[model samples]
Target: MTAKTLFEKIWDAHVVAAESTDTPAILYVDLHLVHEVTSPQAFTELRERGLKLRRPERMLATLDHSTPTLPTAANGERPYANDEAKAQVAQLESNCREFGVALHGWDSADRGIVHVIGPELGVTQPGMTIVCGDSHTSTHGAFGALAFGIGTTEVGHVMATQCLLQRRPKTLAIHVDGQLPQGVGAKDLILHIIGQIGVDGGTGHVIEYRGPAIAALSMEQRMTVCNMSIEAGARAGLIAPDETTFAWLQGRPQAPQGAAWDAAVARWRRLPTDAGARFDREVRIDATAVKPTVTYGTHPGMAIAMDAPVPPARNAQEKRALEYMQSQPGQPMQGMPVDVVFIGSCTNSRLSDLREAANVLRGRRVASRVRMLVVPGSEAVRRDAEREGLHQVFTAAGAEWRVPGCSMCIAMNGDLAQPGQLVVSTSNRNFEGRQGKGARTVLASPATAAASAVAGSIADPRDYLVEVAA
Candidate 1:
């Protein structure tokens, strides 16, 4: 076997010994976050088996995927009127209560998207193993943890044993060099990389994001980068813990306290790859070459610079994706008309993202022909943005500022794009019908989305940003 990379070392450390080559390996899971969509079936399985959660204290449950932005304003009103959704949330609450797992539900100030709540609450620390039922659980990897999504069955496995059987994945070091140009954000950078690597280039591997450009991103930006690792066909994405990670951890509820904090930081400082560590694969990207980007086809990788013409469908896969997206090649992404603009999701719904969108939209009105929506990733983010008047900016721009949840990103709830409607979105993933059936979605940065919302068409933020700065 080759000398292990940091990801492999971390994985081996978490392994509680293997069962068999085909059977599951018992790998300790430091944190388990349960959400409504994936927990119901797992809970059902547990009830059927007469098994309780092995260690409830290590698990946290919340309702997000199925919760609506509105709850009836009456006595005993539930936020979700869908009976199945209500049951899922109710079951999760019951499971957590009966098994003593902590829960943050609709009324709880701590409630939000599981991925969003974990890091904000300090439950996702560096050098930890975190798993959730949601695929974007990789978002927590921003803290330098081995975080990834699991299936419902695997969710049960984690609940029953606080361990999972996972195959050791190859490691790919994605070295992003140089500083990102002005107006380019993490979303743009990841999109640019995906465009270069193709969506499935990192299959069967875990990606370690490294180098000056990757290290320069803020915690939220790092989350945005790692959140889309799965789109690149990586099992997970990680960054080595550093001062930026520690600064974000301090003072949070689950973060270490007093001297414990100092000790934890000291340990985190040592989490980087040791000298001479080896990776199975490597890719390099120049951040300075990346510009504002948008997806023109169904896949995230089928993207180009905002000002560039759409690429021709050169192959079978490209042709299929292009046909599904109904996009013509060689057409400029900019000035492409849109019907809806969405700014939220686990990928780019943090407070800073909201602030950036707000800064771009301030004193500007969204086009009357376009409908815009802003959904905060979590309740805490929603509250903070409102306190800072970010909501006001969105609303003033004729955008609907909804409550916290993964609205429109996965379409689990009522928020979805209408058929044939083109949407300019900040959320990751623009795959076929990702927003809704026949609804075209173009992934862009928050600034780009804001600019598009105002212009009623795809437009670069640099165009408006320069004028505003001037």
Candidate 2:
């Protein structure tokens, strides 16, 4: 066995003890979060097996994807175009009540995206193991926790046992150095890394984000970086919990308090990889080299600098991806027309992201042909933004400021792109039909999305920010 990195050490600590290579190992899960889209089947399985949730207090449910974006009236009925979506939300509510799991539904102010709510509500903490049905569960790993997505069957296992039989994944250290360039954000950095490594490069591994650049990022920015680790096929992505992480956790509902809080922070401060710790694989990226990035093809890896033209892909897979995206090699990403722009998701829906987009949209109107929407990750974020007057800036610029939900990031709810429309979005994934059937999605930073919305094409935010600053 190789010398373990911090991820390995953490995973080893969480293992309750292994059975055999084929047999599942009972790994402890500190947190379990469920959402409407993936929990109904698992809940049904639980009912069939006559198994109750092992730890009701450790698990929480929220209605996000299936809940309608429309505001509810005093009668409590939402304006949902699809009854089945509402039915899923109802099912989740019922299952959580039946299993004694805490739920944040449409009526709850705390409700939002599962990943978003976890960290915001203090349910996600350092040195914990968190699992959810959604792939973006890596979002919690930003707090230096072991977090990953589980399939429905695994969700059922967690619901019943509060443990997972998990295979320990190898560790990969991704070192990012130097300060990022102006207008470059964590979304740009991750997209650039994914472009360099290809989407499948980190399969069967856990990635530990390190180096000066990673250290310099705020907790929300780190969350954005880890959130897309799943897109690169990593089991999880983490940063060692530091002062920033501890500061973010202080006073949160689920975090430790009093003597326990100090003790927990002391433990978390020691969670970093020991000096000379070895990783199975390592990759280094110079943050200064990353520019405002945009995806040209369906996969997150199929990206290039906003100012640069797409490079020719000599391989068959590259050629196919280019063809599917209707993108030509050597074509510049700049000046490419877009029909829609979205600035929200688990990846970039935090208050900082909204503030950045608002900064770009202030005193400028959105392009006449471009339709823009800003969806806060959670109800709390929506309320916070409105309190800070971010919503006014967005609406004044002709961008729709909708209720909190996973609006157009995924088609789970009623909001989605029209068929064949191209969108510049801040969401993590750009997989085929990820936004909607036949909708072309280009992943970009919130600033870039705002710039694109103003220009009606793929434009770099640096251009606008410089002009506005001057």
- Model 2 misplaced regions, further than 4 Å: 1-4, 73-76
Quality of model 2 by C-alpha lDDT: 0.88
Which regions of candidate 1 fall more than 4 Å away from where they truly are? Answer: 1-4, 18-24, 74-81
Clashing pairs in 2: none
Tens digits of per-residue lDDT for model 1, 399-458: 999888888898868888988899999998897788999899999999999999999999
Enumerate residue pairs that collide in model 1.
Answer: 25-165
- Per-model TM-score, in order, reads 0.96, 0.97
- Every candidate's lDDT: 0.88, 0.88
lDDT of 2 by residue, 1-470 (tens): 45556686677778887758678678989899999988899999989988888898999888877666667778977877588887887888888888898899866889988899999888898878999999999999999899999999999989888899887788889999998987899999999999988889889999999999999999999999999999999999999888899899899887889999999888887788888888889999999999999999888988789888888877887787677667778888888889999998889999999999999999999999999999998888998999999999999999998777777888778788887888999998788888889888999999999999999998989999999889
